[model samples]
Target: MAFSSDLDQITRAASGDRQAVSALVNRYSPGVLALATRMLADRAEAEDVTQEAFIRAWKALPTWEPRAKFSTWLHRVALNLCYDRLRKRRDSTMAELPERVDMALRPDDALDQSERVQAVEGAIAALPERQAAALTLCALQDHSQAEAAAIMEISVEALESLLARARRTLRTVLMERSEA
Candidate 1:
């Protein structure tokens, strides 16, 4: 199958095929950057995390077992790096704030789409890390409940519980902001 060929490329990269590794980087870097940006909310920090994640992935490739999809593995790496940066910031008393998406350019946009996006992102950023991770992995990243649960190392039922709470909290936050 076509999927197996992609997996072969990853395996080849793991075996020190530089071209294969570079190709993998080219293929997955954008997605990684997007995911990091969504999770971290700071473009510069997200870029840094994205770079570090690739470096880490390259270093760890030889040890990688092809048990899961390569993209899934890469996502886990990116998520771990984001959490590490957040933890470091927390320890240093320098928690970075989420960036507000600009909405001034298109005031007539349907349903105030820009404002809603900013509000949702802000609410997600304010969530507890686990809840945010769950929402990001499931809702934003389009991972199935099983896949998200697998990535989070939680049981399916536990993931469902987390998803429920995350959605409820997000709704409350958005509604409260709308009422303000």
Candidate 2:
């Protein structure tokens, strides 16, 4: 149903239909933004990646062959952009200074919950890129295993392996944090 709807919208969008383009953006922008945010851990960078992905999508629409689901292809594009950014980070020689946490400040329940969420996100951000991507797609975003696998351009088994490793690492990291 989504596939067909997307195809219709894509067709309309290809012919410079503003409503169709708006509909497509409204439908997919949040998802693209979320995926980029999870992958990059930087809201600004994620927004940039989302905008770039849409720009690329618009360009491709005219010649777009429906070889893969539009969502899958768009996600792959976003993921690749993420990979490029990650690579750039790795290539840079400067080490980023860690943000200081004020452990001295006591927190209310809401602040505690916020801290917990930050902990989990920090753990996820520490993961290897592929593992992080798998966990983000499957666990955070609720994508089906098949869809996540397609987006990552990996076999389902490979995706499962990455997820397993990510889960294990998160468990260990969170447990250690709790103990501290």
The lDDT leader among the candidates is 2
The TM-score of candidate 1 is 0.81
Report lDDT (CA) for all predictions: 0.77, 0.84
Tens digit of per-residue lDDT, candidate 1, span 34-75: 777767777899899888888888787777777887777777
Q: Could you estimate the TM-score for every candidate?
A: 0.81, 0.90
Clashes of each: 0, 0
Pairs with steric clashes in candidate 2: none
Q: Candidate 2 versus the native: TM-score?
A: 0.90
Distance from true position, residue 40, model 2, in Å? 1.0
The global Cα lDDT (0 to 1) of model 1 is 0.77
Candidate 2 lDDT, tens digit per residue, 75-163?
89999999998888878955242232222222343446666666666667778899989999999896889999999999999999999
Question: Candidate 1, residue 30: CA error in Å?
Answer: 3.1
